[model samples]
Target: MTIASCGSVSATTLGLPNSTAIPAEKARLPKGLFVAKIPVSAKTKQRLANDIESITMLSLLQARNTKLAAGTRVPEILVIGLRLHEPNAAVPTDIVELIAMQRKSGMLFVCVRDADFEGTTRQECAFAVRRALPARAGHTTTSKVFASDWQPAGEATLNATDPAVDSMDALWESLCSQVILDDPSPIDVNTRLARRMQIAQLTAQVDKLTRDHQRAKNPEQRNEIYAKLHKMKRQLEELQGQ
Candidate 1:
């Protein structure tokens, strides 16, 4: 995959509008018969492959257990190898074609890499991927791809001295949580309306809190009101950002 320079492009350039309303449809990890593709060079291929396999197995097992407990169908996940050229170079046509083919087959594609070809941080690379994702609509898009970095946290340290290592279990847990939350289901009109109603209710609560805060005379009471106001604002942001 081509790793674009961070801050090199704006959302507008990617055809994303600056709107407060979240997209009605979201790109999600498939619940059944999905695919994860990990591409690495031959030098680090075996180690990276092992790590990806372990992570996928752990996540799928956990997801299956949760689904079974909820009386939902247990999902089937498959991990496959995907070879890519050097990171800084354009993505190979074959890899792009493969992604298109997989999406057509109703399979989700996740790209697992340790870092961008230019050595960008994992978090930044994820952000770039997110930015590249097309805006969600009522219909499915041709590309349903996600990416992640698997490097150990200890590689980057504060003060360039004492490093903190994150366990593989922790990374897997985090990735699985993201997959579950980002489920690609489209929200129906009714659901959208319902969400809007909830947002309205929360807005009313915020207004009431603001009024109360203004009336609060004692320092302690004012502090409490401010705290409530802060929490309400955060909830509003989350709902608006959807």
Candidate 2:
């Protein structure tokens, strides 16, 4: 019900009232441009992957070829459909137990019945990432947001899925700007590649945690994981912010 105005024309953020107005809040937690959630099922999980495929561009050239930007329409998720439906609900085993098996592979599955708020008609389907959204975003799924489902949406895929990929490119660019930060000089090609690769490998683990903590179904588990993730992110950014 409360909306914060930051004058940013990019992604519409949904959080507690005034969340956006709080400086640095959005920076720590990435926000999605489009949002939706679907009950989880075997069919729905496959559908969610299909949903992500619809919005993503595999390469830069393909992005331009399709008139899409690298970040546009990318999905950040709140995995739903992985819960125990209370008393004697004789359904397939434990949903969480089933999902946890997939989590062991470090992959998440999610879905949503509504895309662009199409009036809950159940006819139209919107993938995890979409081309449209509520005039104001409410990805948090709280009482004020998506109360009916009450899911926990995380920030994993919002900015960069691979820390190694993102940070290495940034470090490369920083090295190029050798005029400042005393960028150790990239005069040697082999050294540069080796160093960049090392940095990428180190950061990728932390990046994976960020995405995981956000979409976790259990609050206690999510918080424990996120504490570690936040610490790692701060440390990594400080290294990059150098």
Candidate 3:
């Protein structure tokens, strides 16, 4: 059930050299799952290789495909477009097997660089997880596995480049079913006071920009600041969602 784009580009940029499909280890379901679109960079893959195990192997393409069929998926799937990257990235097979044997929770969104280690750990982990689930290929009226999306934003421990979110809107929409767009809800009362303060500031900025656009002296001025205002609005929206 593994899917690659029909287009000619690399999966790293949204296309794959091969349209090969691989099946899962078994058709059984796992206790936990983390379906996410994480951007893994080459540097990040190399650094985290030791932290991972065989359970991260990309042998569960079938289960992953089934997850997609069941209306579940991380926002995006990438391979960093590298041919030499090995599945599991040197993760110990025993550790991988241990993960395979355990029951997991919800899917986690992973963040990775531009398809650098995507083929290595991203796919490997995905395959291992789906493979661990002993489910056979068939439509499920119900499933416990859930999906999430992630983009690396420079976590200090990962030592990787932060992902730029500008071009991932379509991907995000796909992952979270944003096609049925609705007016955002009111602010979450549970949010931290500091975070609420930032949201307030961003709100004020959006209002000011709206005013400036209304009184803009020229089209260029309006357009330039309008983009900035839109950016601020999006950032606020992202934070709110978080």
Candidate 4:
């Protein structure tokens, strides 16, 4: 069902302007359907039903309506928040990707959960960005999901700024940079995301090699695993420029 847009509300919680706040109903998705008419696995559909307590579209920024510049392909940006039923539970990455691809919009997802911080239980949120590139042959290619460490809900805001940009595409990049709290480099957002993905792969390889090194009974096997680990670490360091 197409969500009926709620009138303007304050989006200060997400550091967005009040004018952009267009809160919609919590049951934004139909009871048994995928968004944008895309098909999804039953497992994914089930997870959506069980894991998510509510889905709220906090902000909808578009070129024609908002101050943000028009993008060549991307006409709008969606800031969607998913409140989990269990504070510790995680929504699968594939599910997120499916929604982003099907929506065909630049998406900023906020995963809200309750956590104990400073000896008190309070709400916290993590940010994720998955910008889909222009379609090719009716297929959409999405960027690797770039996420930020969890922080107090509504505390962190989009901090990146570019006064010269005139496209929603550039604003999307800035939003990505905002979510990735660790990397503050001046490099382009796409390049930084590529590096992050490579680093993640290298880390996984190194972790497996470490496990192999521990399980190896023979010195030769241990040495081989150690060598592989070193190579992986070197690649990681180069990607990180350290």
Q: Every model's Cα RMSD, please?
A: 18.2, 20.0, 18.4, 5.1
- Model 1: per-residue Cα lDDT over 1-242, one tens digit each: 22111122222222222221112132122212223464434534433333322111111222322221221221322222222223332222233233345431122223333345355644211210111223347755443233433322223111101112122222222233233233222223235434655788889999999999999899999999999899989989998897
Runs in model 2 deviating more than 4 A are 1-195
lDDT for each candidate structure? 0.35, 0.31, 0.33, 0.66
- Evaluate residue 224 in candidate 1 and report its C-alpha lDDT on the 0 to 100 scale: 94
Give the C-alpha miss distance for residue 143 in model 4, angstroms: 5.4
- lDDT tens digits, residue span 1-242, model 3: 54321112222222112332212333222212311234444544443343422121111222233232221433333221111233323323233333323333212122122223545423321111112122336844322222222222232011011132122222222222211111111122123323645787999999999999989999999999999999999989987886
Model 4 lDDT per residue over 59-168, tens place: 77777655766887677888877777776555446656766766676888777777777787777777787754333466767566656787766575664345644567
Give the candidates in order of lDDT, highest first: 4, 1, 3, 2
Listed in order, each prediction's TM-score against the native is: 0.25, 0.21, 0.22, 0.74
How far off is model 2, as Cα RMSD? 20.0
Give me candidate 3's TM-score against the actual structure. Answer: 0.22
- Whose lDDT is greatest here? 4
- Lowest lDDT sum, 10 consecutive residues, model 3, at 153-162
Candidate 3: count of backbone clashes, pairs at least 3 residues apart or interchain: 33
